[model samples]
Target: MSVHEEISKKTNKTWGIIQTYRKLDEKREAEIEKVILQCQNNEAFSVDQINKVTEEINSFAAINHLPSRKFVTKQMVEEAAQN
Candidate 1:
């Protein structure tokens, strides 16, 4: 899968886990923070340093916010236009 697809899948799964936990709230807690912790523990994502960093950055802002847009260079766009 592409990076965008993977990010979307992870984002959705994170939301699903958070929602499920919300319904079973026996004790009140920071739901978003809890979900992020659970995601951080997953072996599929935590094994690679780069992946872990990306996951943490995205997960920490998954709720009530969006990831900041990255700057694109003119050369980057021109290169893409050549494809």
Candidate 2:
């Protein structure tokens, strides 16, 4: 597979696993959705911001050899929230 295809497969597989375990907590989901919508409306989610976040997450996973959900860190979440 190509490098792009490999990354895409990995990402999709990871998200699939995450989705299986995710509990649909309505309130939290709604809050997250609201924040995402606000960011979208404000054009706060820029391409560089996305790339930085993705790089950080990928680095964390590579350094730790962690599974997808475990790749998420408090620091990562905080950085994303601030952006």
Judged by TM-score, which candidate is best?
A: 1
State model 2's lDDT: 0.49
Please give the clash total of every predicted structure, in order: 0, 0
lDDT of 2 at 21: 33
Tens-place lDDT per residue, model 1, 2-81, is 99999999999879766644443322223333434545454221223333344544454465364522233334333433
Quote the positional error of residue 20 for candidate 1 in Å: 0.3
Q: List the candidate 1 regions with Cα displacement exceeding 4 Å.
A: 26-83
Query: What range of 10 consecutive residues in model 1 has the weakest lDDT sum?
Result: 43-52
The lDDT per prediction is 0.44, 0.49
Q: What is the lDDT of residue 43 in candidate 1?
A: 22
What TM-score, over all chains together, does every model reach? 0.31, 0.29
Q: List the residue pairs that clash in candidate 1.
A: none
Q: Residues 1-83, candidate 2, lDDT per residue (tens digit)?
A: 89999999999987864453343223334444454555546544333433444454455555546443222343444455666
> Distance (Å) between predicted and true CA of 4, model 2?
44
For model 2, the stretches where C-alpha displacement exceeds 4 angstroms are 1-45, 68-83
